[model samples]
Target: MTSVVTAGGVSVTMRGPVVDEAEAVLDRLVTDGVPASLMAKNAQLWGPEAVEEASRRLGWLDLPETSRPLLPELAALVERVRADGLDRVVLAGMGGSSLAPEVITRTAGAELTVLDTTDPQQVASVVADRLERTVVVVSSKSGGTIETDSHRRVFEQAFRDAGITGEDLARRFVVVTDPGSPLEKTAREAGYTVVLADPDVGGRYSALTAFGLVPSALAGVDVARLLDEAAALVPALHQPYDNPGLALGAALGASALGGRDKLVIADHGSGITGFGDWAEQLIAESTGKEGKGILPVVVEGPDAPGFAEAEDVRRVLLGARPEDSGLGVSGPLGAQFLLWEYATAVAGRVLGINPFDQPNVQESKDNTAALLRGAAEGEAPTVVAGEPALVVGAVEVHAPAELLRGATDLTGVLEAVVAAIPEHGYLAVMAYLDRFADAGAERLRPLLAQATERLRKTPAAVTFGWGPRFLHSTGQYHKGGPRNGVFLQITGESAQDVPVPGKPYTLRSLQLAQAFGDLRALRSRGRPAVRLHLRDRAAGVEQLLSALA
Candidate 1:
């Protein structure tokens, strides 16, 4: 742990064993061409105030009082959902409102889905079908999210179409927002029950509040379990080396001085999907200024999988650490963030960019909009197909015997295929090999060095989480970056179809499988790539890695 004086004259220490010598590493990073201005900006973002605010906000005291009057009422609502035979809960909102529920669902492995996009088909499907059986949790701190309102309008129509009207909407729909926000007013006027989000708490930080809790509870997740997990982190905050979150913020802030442009947050599970959005808002809104910001890139692996091969793309920062005894203190979500904070700071300092900004994010949006505009007029983006370039390596085919045995089921079969790949010792990717995170650069650092040593040039290392979300955030980069990576695409076929009870949506397993296929199709064109299909998915992780060899 290193101690530094904040600009406020207060001494704050990041509590963790340093990955490398901080100042020496920082010096070496700058010598490599990191801008000094970025360093100065990060120094300010990680100064006393920012760190203090983060600690407090992430700590126990920042959460609502445990005994608030609404606790039991909230609990009752959740219990009711479970008893009513609902199988999935859908949340509608974008950014902060969307990310919190995502984290909670992931941490608890809840059967809740969050939709933040304005896709009409997606909205129509969920509202037209699921809303009748599954509850809808609409979260908007400002109560004026155009997307949220749009979803609500669609949901209301669905309710009416189902012969469920008026007061019944209050039972099936819930709203989380500040008092008098347009959402609040709409909810009250529309006869929907309201759960107030803390006015003082910003949207990005309201996951632990009503924004995250209501949906989490409805999904049968234990919200209190999450709080207890967070509370357990209190003692660690005061001791510098013991605190993961603070250490992360500091190291990442310090890394921004070094020139690391990407902080990839790699994870799996639908519940955690919102994490990317949360990180997106947090880093983009907080650390973007003074011309230096670290792009918070998030990627996921084989629950969804694809790796990018773009030269202009930046480093990969793996967020998960090996599970430790201390982790028992916090819930999985808390542990995920605590570990991520440390990695984020480390990547920021090494990269010399503030981890709080969205640098390359705009390029994708602009490009996509332009492509859409052209397409609207019956003009499609031009694609010039060249020779098939086998980039990553040849796609290995298991013996007929092995493939047949593996084909009994998707999970197991996929595991066997991946386990065949020899583990690359020097490059440490996320536990799941195929996904990328904002912090993934740290994992790829050694591989990068090795590649640079052999090829005399660096390849862009890009990552995306779940297949659908990546198509939104980094699709443009993958399509446009100078193709130079061995894209590693990983996905699994379903073993048993877990039907959505009475709903026509066969099972989430199929939807996810199809999404992965769509992602693969996007990457296979003009690039040398290999796709491995795992029909049996229950295979163990070690077995999967062995197959990858």
Candidate 2:
């Protein structure tokens, strides 16, 4: 039987054998006062003081209550932007720094574009037309994120190209970062407006703070109302079974423990589609470490194209009501943000893991840095030419026979890879092609469906995302989380390439480097991963679809 819980205009429908256990866990959490303790800064429940030191960064727990008071200041900033006629915003960030703002802009109709990807074409596509009126928001918690820094550098040059320099350029820029961080120092020196984020809040949890709200305010969203609605969930945090956050978190942890580890979040007309991206980073980074984690698969709808079908998947439906229009958008989204944050913390407790730390996410970053520094010394990706296609890396060849054996074409390689996933494992289909290649990516859905049917024998999950983008988002969870993933990296030759302003490499080169770097990082960790490169986007997707058929 399916169980449904509705709160604050948001509904969570959970179905699985672990539903009861999740409820029990929620009850225990309430009885133990876990949520309240966390809010009270009780770090002992998480783990040793050292192991869970990050847990003390719980200022986000009070953001809704605390940030409500800042609405006037935020509104003033927004008014200034409007008065200055700044019509567009280009947010330069990565992961936690970017996802929440992206959601706010999407749901609130903010005239803002998030530049979280380092792909040159993506960067060009964003700033090409709006360079004159766009205000660049350089957001980063550490202030030294490689991708954010790269984006800032590129856009700074773009601003200069548009003849906006010195005080003018500073007027067109804002910096959201912690006090004394490199970005704050740089922004102060450059005369950019600096919004200091609460140092006690981690990046993934900073949604209610300036990292998320400033952009929301700039986008014309009602920050005061959003905070007020978000604050409503505060009282429920102390409750046990009736609390939405505790219930949802227990379900997530219990489901994973029961073998349904894939959390497929289905957003059905919720106006919060971008919430999935934010939730993905929150859940993945917080709990995906210490060789255990829950996989979050955010889909548009249950019927979304290329949606994963597997027994290990537990669907979480985010449904919207007809009355939920305009400012009402904040109600559901704000509640969800708080719900998931609380639930992730509870789930971490259930899993006996520290919810605040991300230990494995740095491996890929380190590897990418090594590759960029030319310090990555290893064998190049092995290549094999076949009919109308070429296989790069040993991903498919190294896959289980059930997944790849008896294959007659390039599609068979994908078939085999999907078939190789264990009952408790998952398939991460990462595409490094253009974001516009949605139709091409959709062609592989039938294959995923077929793989899902096969997965019933053992049960697994499938996830798909565009590259470099996912690198900043799910990339952390994939590398740092549990070792239950079988990775399939897809790449195609770019039709055209754009170069970074002062970098030696083109966007295409950088994309490939990131791909290769991630592959090396995965293999270095002894995880199963493979790669397939197509000659060009069109022909590659077409051939692969044909081969699958």
Candidate 3:
């Protein structure tokens, strides 16, 4: 792990399976970009002593009696779903509301297919297929979550198409939302059961609450065990020096305030990817504002994309403090973890914003709606296949040492990637672009800076599609981007594969590539313009990537 002390006097350590690389990346970031103002803000929000004080008072791992009431409710709901004979559960929401449970499920080793995408075909497929054996759980704190509502409509229509409308729709579905929101009314009107999301609990913070519990119950995950695990950390989580979560949270927040605004959560194995995604949505939605935000990044496994050479870009996963270094307990049970959330919550309170209400978050829904509308009207276009595969030109590939030298400039590196893989119609590199490390900064800085320079040098719209969880969120954007998004889709052969039971999709190369192909079609002029391929892993797996770059 490499550690950097922020101007606020908070030290952040970026830990990952690849300690040497991660350390180097952190050192580079601390030296190159963190600003004083941000550090100061972080200092106010996550100072060590303050964090310690907060932990001691909150009893790091202690759950208030008020919060305790939720466990039974959640457990009961699980029994209800199971008793009702539902085998699948679809969580209908975006960002924080959706990510955390999926994370816990994967981490705890539970099997439940989570649908967080808005693609019509994907949505229809999940519903039509899963509805027979599963129960769709529509979750949103605000009943008005446009995306959730859209999903509800899809579900309703699916039921209607199956001639299972009216009471049947209600029986097949349940809702986890605000008690008095429009969603509750809709769920009730449609005849489905409802579970209220506490008004006091924000989406990100609600994970320990029903946000995680409800889905957990449906999946037959041991909610009690997970909670007990969380409960054990209560005291330590609240103590600054002793609480790993608080320590981690403060350090990470301080780092962001210091100018390391991009966070990358690299999962060495199965559980971490979902956790990374969960953390990404939490920080992105909470801390992103007022001329500042921490961009959270998630890398599922070693073979996952985003690993570029040393000179190009490197990935880092922010983790809990020293003492909390055990597998499940390590990442979430430290002072840094608590402090980061506290700092984010405090910042929101200072901003007079309801961190709980993600209002403009609905813009994504509007975009999707507009795209679908356009597609239907023939004004918005459908992704077509591109021409026969084109052969890419070869480029001189540099050694990893040389690559590290150019690590700070991502645009040049990406251009090299494009040149190497020129034959592929679309090229998306999985290089680390998280803001938490110098490597990430270096990785993305060049591309953005180059784009700026290019715009200055010329007037073209330097088009780029950059996102951490773009697989779900920006597929529409990439597939829908002006037929110009070079889709450099990345996938890796998983060390472990979980087949969808009886379903033909085996989570293997064919299905994974098929998913990539769905994204590729967006670049088609009715031709095969998209290229899909795989790597052994994110690190040494650049064998194919280097061949193209």
Candidate 4:
């Protein structure tokens, strides 16, 4: 069964049994106005002054109120950039800081390039030509994000190399961070423009805050109109039954409880193309905890092949315009951000967890820091190489027997693993290769889908994530949340290396360390994981595709 509902300019079409399960909860929430009460100033949702006092951190609930007065400031910054003739904006941040800006720039067609990866190749690509005309926005809520700091240092030198120095160098940079964060002081000391983010807001929920707005403004998006559209949905969310947020929340939570834990997003048009990555972080980090989670599987589009037989998946089709027989709407991109935030909060309540806190996110960070420290102390971490390579059509590939039992090649291994996954389980391809490489982990999607359909006689969701980057996003959930994932970690040798600014190691070394560190962390958590070492990225991709085909 399918149904479509439109509210606040956005239309959602619900499909599958999850919709039926969600309606009962939606009815209760609407009648009680639970989600709306959470939005009230200083209101308590979790309990009396206990978690309630902590819920003050829920400033994202009232972002419109906080952001309304900052409109003039945002507009003035946009005008200043245009008047100064800056041609590009480079945002350097991680996770929440980077995802929103990246989506905004891509969707709005703004001249902004996000530098989120620590890959030297990725970093070099950003400053290859536009150092002089680019305004670098260094964003980090904690102001101490190692990646953002490294990026800031790297680009600061790039500006210096380009002959921009001292106070003039400050003109080419802006810092967005919490008011009293270390980055704020550093920016002030260096005379760079500083935009203070709300301290009460968490990074994942800070999309409507200065963290998201500054970059959106720089990207030529009409920030005021975006907020206005988002604000329009607030009243609708308060209504309960007709509330879009409540409906979305109920659907997601109920679906996960019903064994449809995979939330597959299918965008019908380019309007919502980049939104999946942003939503992935929100849903995964928010609801994924205490040995339970809702995995977000973002597909290319509705017509994407291979998932037709997936059973543990729920499909969401995001359309810019309404379909003839289903739901549709026209709303600013900002409205979607607000809608998801509200929906995620509601889902958290449904799942009985704190959506605001990411308790396990720190584990991998600590592991990475330890690895770096060990290297600095002359105690290099052991590099475990996968052995007994399987020969597949002239290419030798390394994969674990658990992932390829009774298999002589990569294709057989994929089939064996797909068959081995328990009912309702998922496959996660954790790739540590460079994002620029076409022969990476994502290529295995279709094969996994095919294997799931053919061998399991059920649909299984497939997920692809780049290493170290996902550490800040879904990594927490993978380790601390559910035991539903069967991981295939992909790694390859770097063709070249670039040294970290002040470290004895290169960026490639850092990446490998992070990958190894995360692998160790997952193993320590008893996660079912296997490593595949490719003969360089391209060959690795080619061999995997050949084997699967």
lDDT of 3 by residue, 127-215 (tens): 66756666777887778754466567666766666787666567777788866888888777767888775565556666655666677
Off by over 4 Å in 4: 1-4, 41-54, 320-330, 379-403, 437-441
lDDT of 1 by residue, 1-549 (tens): 333322111122322222342445544434543333222223343444354343333321346344144568887777776676666788887565766677677655667777764433344455555655778888887776544665676666667768887666667788888877988887887787788866655555555777777877777777776655555554443343434444345455554454443444444332344466555545544454444455455545422122332222222223333121101111245434434433344454444444433334344344444443444465533221122222112222222343324344433443332333222211112211212211232333333323433332332333323333443333333443323223334434333333332223332322333333333343444433334333333343233344333
What are the clash counts of all predictions, listed in order? 83, 3, 64, 4
TM-score of each: 0.54, 0.88, 0.57, 0.91
lDDT of 2: 0.71
Which of the numbered candidates is closest to the native, going by highest TM-score?
Answer: 4
lDDT of 1 at 244: 46
* Comparison by lDDT, 1 against 3, better one: 1
Ranking of candidates on TM-score, top first: 4, 2, 3, 1
Q: Comparing 3 and 4 by TM-score, which wins?
A: 4
Each candidate: what lDDT?
0.46, 0.71, 0.44, 0.74
Q: Number of the top candidate by lDDT?
A: 4
Write the number of the candidate with greater TM-score, choosing between 1 and 2. Answer: 2
